[model samples]
Target: TQLLEQSPQFLSIQEGENLTVYCNSSSVFSSLQWYRQEPGEGPVLLVTVVTGGEVKKLKRLTFQFGDARKDSSLHITAAQPGDTGLYLCAGGGGGATNKLIFGTGTLLAVQP
Candidate 1:
């Protein structure tokens, strides 16, 4: 089975800090998605990068997919208290299931 592992399961920082989270896997995926979730709510899509070596940016967040499609990264710049949430990376397989395999997640706390 394919699996995604995330690093620094927890993070705390002062407002306006910067951080990077990594998602890795041994299996290649057709597409990968990044989602940010707040407490007691479902995750909202941040971005989806499909092509290998693809890079997408949203505000202070930057997402990159590895050339091998087996890994991805999320970089946050000048993070604010509003950025505090659970970050997740999901991979989409090419099979008929087309289900998303989610990472363990990273809980970020940005202090004001």
Candidate 2:
């Protein structure tokens, strides 16, 4: 599978803590998306960022795209146990196949 390269691949935090996860690539993407995956289900799309330097907020989470469309980051504030999951970023390039290159991922575990 294609990987987008993520940083801080594993994270262990207490409930109500804050964390930031990063996804990066040498090549620029047409768009980038973030997803949250639980243990037994398919990945759930969180947000899509198409423009450079754009930022979107969802409740306690914030998403940002790099200026050149080559990277993205996700920040979660006051995380809870319910937020524990595998967070992934998928970079969509302007290739013919339109394949989504996913990040290596950040496995977040929020302890109670």
Candidate 3:
């Protein structure tokens, strides 16, 4: 089993604004991943951070992993209405099962 913590449990922003979400943990894992989830259906994997201090960007989204591999962050540039949803961070054991320990998560609401 694994555990994670997220900050600013809730965020509300206007379209074209910028925001950031963070995930932190005391435990280390082989890999860390970010997902954007809407209601009903399963979460969609946004990106994965394996090495410490790794940084990746997807369009207006930027993801960063902590140097110690114990934390991660997601930054959104010029947020849009479609960006409204639940953002989650999950950790992997680097094993064969692809098992995940999910973070409590942060909720983002972008109002147009």
Highest lDDT among the candidates is held by which one? 1
- Write down the worst ten-residue block by lDDT for model 3: 1-10
Model 1 regions lying over 4 Å from their true place:
none
Q: TM-score of each candidate?
A: 0.98, 0.95, 0.94
RMSD after CA superposition, every candidate: 0.6, 1.5, 1.2
lDDT of 1 by residue, 1-112 (tens): 9999999899999998899999999999999999999999999999999999999999899999999999999999999999999999999998899899999999999999
Give the TM-score (vs. native) of candidate 3. 0.94
* Residue pairs with backbone overlap in model 1: none
Highest TM-score against the true fold, candidate: 1
The Cα local distance difference test for each model comes to 0.96, 0.93, 0.93
Q: Name the runs in model 2 displaced over 4 angstroms.
A: 1-3
Over the stretch 49-83, how does candidate 2's per-residue lDDT look in tens digits? 99999999999999999999998999999999999
Task: Give the runs in model 3 whose Cα sits over 4 Å from its true position.
Answer: 95-97
TM-score computed on alpha carbons, candidate 2 = 0.95
